[model samples]
Target: MSVLRSGSPHRPARSLATVAGILLALVSLLLGLPGTAGAAATQRAPEPRHPEQDWAGSQIARHEGTADGGAPPAAPLASVEGVDVSSHNGNVAWSTLWNSGVRFAYVKATESTSYTNPYFAQQYNGSYNAGMIRGAYHFATPDTSSGAAQAAYFVSHGGGWSKDGKTLPGALDMEYNPYGATCYGLSAAGLVNWMKDWFATYKARTGRDAVLYTSTGWWKQCTGNSAAFGAVNPLWIPRYGSSAGELPAGWGFHTIWQYTSSGPTVGDHNRFNGAMDRLRALANG
Candidate 1:
């Protein structure tokens, strides 16, 4: 028989009881139970975020229209949602994007005359395989090379067109100059001529006019409000500040509008300027 150190036969039972009390206290503290030591410690609140800031790229930005806010433009200009991607987005799971309600995608194919997106094949074809209307775009560098040369390079790489009724026409991305000289050191008329030369060559090669992607401000500053491209080429305008902003001269309406860069997918968020039928018609060409 084991003798208790204290002259009490119940000493072991008392000691066990003490230990059990201590264990319960530890568990309470660990779990931050009410009236426990851990409950006294303060926890800082999470940092605040802006309406437009979606750091994870999992949430669409505020400007993206939802049913709760309002429907997209109406009638002749009602919209269907879409997106555009570049090398910056890296490799994307195209189905995930399509499931997220993206009906179309414009993948970055070429920049200037030499640079081609290494992932062009996967993005361009993957989008199609995943059931999204697909197209390619070229970032213009008119300062370093003529528009026709870049267009040629663009098409040869991945900007080519087919009458498959699922391929949207290629786009000319002539936005703010990412390189030196914002206007490419060209006068307004010179810019117009360069665009015409590129468009003309692209038409001759592909038999379809390339979409023109630009902003009202950029068009005014660089092209001197030239409406020369308004009649033929579809306009893909970017105006993130509002539902719709001033359009470039010549085009009475925009074909596509890039509303936000922080879309749930891996690209800038955009919308078709029409409903399903219109989008299908565009793809047919």
Candidate 2:
């Protein structure tokens, strides 16, 4: 799970009022108050009607097959269904997640430098204890200072993959590194070299090939023409919205298509990462 910190490349922070409301709700629940009591706290507050809507809501709606306006139900996860957990969304209740149709998770482990996730221990421990299949991800950093060191740090702090050989392999999160900008910053050849170094070191330590995660644009600009590395490791491509139907050229054989940034799960407002069975098969393979 990559820490989409306040300074991270993607989305901005949530409003203060939103944070306050969530905290208040949590506090009320902790005090053993009734559900209606918590609901009443904002009855006359003139807040947004869907005030409780958060990432978790988006996820629930997506998973319940209600996201696109009375759309048909999504395919079942009897053989393959998964989610990616990160510190940004905090720790999810393992029981709730399992019951909500999630079969596996790729939890965040480390970012650049020594910045290990605050929730890594809790999420990993809870999921593992529950016997859930899991994998780890390292936030890719091109900050010449210690890219390899950061990779090593993630592996060290995030714990190793499940030994039962059922866990998805580890991944290098190369989406939006503030230091590296995007894969565009690296020349096509440079991108290959960088991935080679990272993957080689990762496999040497974990005994599994590193799964490379990237968005469409990043893949086109950084690795579109590089057969040297792309052919060796599995690719996890992220393409949101209707355009998800259009995958990157030359990389049609991706291991995973992160079709939705929002999917249904218990406890959390919206969970991230959902893929088709074909993608799941590739991951499991």
Candidate 3:
């Protein structure tokens, strides 16, 4: 009944067509269809990550060995036997490990001042009760907190060394990152300085040089194979083979070698590079 104006009869259809075009564009974006901005965004690579879990050799085997490979079939050498354990090794049968001839152990104590192994007391005390020379280790997260702060937290928790013959010096476990970049996003110089802070602070508190745990490849790639701590810190090198392999730069010899990630009886077993007396000597000092 309305008087027609030019282009008026088609107005509703044009509006509906415009709305349909908008809806189609939105659908394309949601679907990340080709030639769309959303598609471009989707095509960008994802950031690197994993569920972070810091431990002894957590990332070492992954980066250093064949995919998911276990320790070599070769039998361990005749040396002072040891083990390194973390919270994952819950309620360790310390007596069984002792019976299996594990004379020494290093238990994960703290990580980056934020995490204290939930099984720390059980593992640390239990290992000692079974007559194994046990030490606490701190998994270094250089990117999370200052080295000094982390060191203090470690000492306050359980990473303390004593002259007690049954307790070995606390060790610092510095290896590849489990969650992010291999070097924890720190440059070689920065990482070196960070560790110096840790060493100095730990020495100041416990009057002991903390043992250093790292792989040769990581040391080279991450720290430029800096040998600054080699003269003081005992190196705990990890290589799952018949031999300990070439050590990282600066150390004349490795003190302890984590030779197997998959031990027949215990968890990960190590071999102190000497006899029981020398093991006791490390504990005493």
Candidate 4:
């Protein structure tokens, strides 16, 4: 007769149920039960990051998607057309590019002190032999070695410049670091100093300033848009857009604009700021 317990509230029972649910969740998580959060998290391996795949504009294209389709903008009547290739391009058909009216080219030659482009000779020499004013570029990996050391390595490889009217100055492909931190884990001031070392060493070795290939966005994030190298380094800005778009802090004008990665022919398409004479003048320097 005293068994009637309906007068009591269910708060305690509800609390016990809540505790039981929590325990069950914990058990599933610990066991990585099928269709649970832990299973989803542990299912796949992360993609491994590797070098050599880090070529010119590779990071930029990853961060900022390129326009691979649609009608390309008409080349400026007074502008010179160009292309840039890397080992990723694998022995570019320079003859075909020349027939397509491409007048200049840049080919990646080195990355840090550890790696060199396997197809560099084919791309670098083939472009010149095809009668295009060509140059070599080094993909900067500032995290691995000192800028001066990397510079030495670059010149010892094919990243050397000449005064020949047919050769353009080597370029420092200093875009976002493909392997790690944006500025190679450096402070803004540190980045500037590192660039200084690279430029000095490269100038001493080649007697010509290396061209800087970078995007304005990366410059802002990595170096706080420092204007230190603008005056001394020729800017080769990559902008896949309707126009060349706004440049970084220091450069008032761009020497070359890589407007589209997916051009009609091969490699990334660029435009020299002036006509053929101006292109030759820059090369002669």
Candidate 5:
């Protein structure tokens, strides 16, 4: 009637309650609330969520099939391509590797405590000197005692990073190894710290950051947070399936995605790595 109170406590409380009610109404609309309000709610609701928006797993699941629903599926990522050229059997022939769509090759250099690849030195040299964009991998030393040493050994023996600054970089392979009893004993944090030490030494020697090669099990059990390693250090994730969809959500921005192990090989037993764009990027970069 006359003059309104300067600062009415009740007015503020009423305003807050009104705001809360509006928020509730909005949420109810989004959730398709029932009753007469539901019809009006639907009209003002937000757009339907994209399949890929909520979860990466869901995204992969949704896009598992070809866009046209054909039997032959398309590649998930458009940009990176890669292949692993380890000393599994023997050296990888560069010419054959290059010809078979091998863009970037991650050569296995060293393994955990006391188990080094005898062919690493020669193979690494051949790959690097032969004008191939390369990355080196140390088959993770879970035994913390020799982690730093193994890393140093890798850098010293693995031909370092490309002199021309064109290679996919280095990595620490942290998958389970059945033979190494000592390695199998360490806790997750112990394994992670060992990798950290290894990568640090490797970087110091080569002047480039090393990638962290791990599977989903290793990531969850060992590394926990994908973002814990930061954005600069590239991640090489391994998933054995038709789709790269099984990879972790935060890991969508991985540097190298090992899509398949059954890729074409070069020599009698030389298996090729996967990824076209990844290889090209490494070479060009």
Candidate 6:
């Protein structure tokens, strides 16, 4: 997501105390003492008390639901609710998320080629433990490093999928650049080339196509509206205000629609284009 965007873009903060705590735990583990990591995983992970209170009350327009728009979609909104999150969300209450009818989640795993979300394991595994279909995504930085290198970094970190029948394929968050240029200093053709490298490398390593999370505007501006990935990669479209709008060049319809960036609960709200059975099939595959 763009740093210029309106929603909580989840800017990363390096907390020395948190790092020191993790280091101490690692040292203890290496010294033959029981580690907190194991305990943290085996037990119910701590849930942020009043997590919703942390909401900045700010939301992106494209993420607003139909109530705010006051106009109905040409077709009914799809069923099967889901959410996507990053560090900006802090500790997620996976139990509450499930109880709230959140059937799935896509957590931010890695960004560019260097940064990985500190809370990836907790969010990803936690959601799975809560019985929600889970997936992970990488924030693409076409300008920072080679796309192949970044994809490798992402998979190694948390973007890899297993055949556990519950892990959704990793998604590539290729939207407006968070840095200086919207297209990250690449021409339209260059952006497409970068995407080709990234997707091919990800698929080669993971044996599954990466989901493409993008908006029509960003796709058009960066990739010159190329629909090359449309057939292979599933489209996760983001459109605000109304339920329907112009789509990116290639796909006739989106497999998943992220209706709002800001929903009643934490993270962005989304829906699968098909029924829950189809969503489950996708997850299983």
| Most TM-score-accurate candidate | 4
Residue 28 lDDT, candidate 6, scale 0-100: 66
| Better lDDT candidate (1, 3) | 3
lDDT per residue for candidate 6 within 1-285, as digits (tens), equals 446445666656779988888987887667755577556555774432322211111222322332443222344545688888887887899999899889999998887766777788889999999999989988777877898999999999999988887899999888765445778899988988898999999989989888898877777877888988888889987775556378888888888777766677878777778777888788767
Best by lDDT: 3
Per-candidate local distance difference test: 0.76, 0.57, 0.86, 0.85, 0.55, 0.77
lDDT of 6: 0.77
Residues 37-118, candidate 2, lDDT per residue (tens digit)? Answer: 4677656543221211211122322322422332113543433455666776687788777776666677777765545667
Question: Over 4 Å off in model 4, which ranges?
Answer: 1-49, 65-70
Judged by whole-model lDDT over C-alpha atoms, candidate 1 comes out at 0.76
Writing each residue's lDDT as its tens digit, candidate 5 over 1-285 gives 545588854443357777777877777667777634576756684543222121111122232331212121255445434456555547667766666554456666665444455666656666667656666676654643467888777676663676455565667776654344433577666666766677778778877777776656546654564455645566666554544345543555666655544444532111122355445554444
Go through the candidates in order and give the C-alpha RMSD of each one to the true structure.
16.5, 18.9, 7.8, 12.2, 21.3, 18.2
Q: Give the TM-score of candidate 5.
A: 0.61
Ranking by TM-score: 4, 3, 6, 1, 2, 5
lDDT for 273 in candidate 5 is 29
Deviating ranges (above 4 Å) for candidate 2: 1-73, 76-79, 144-147, 242-252, 266-285
List the candidates' TM-scores in order: 0.73, 0.62, 0.79, 0.80, 0.61, 0.74
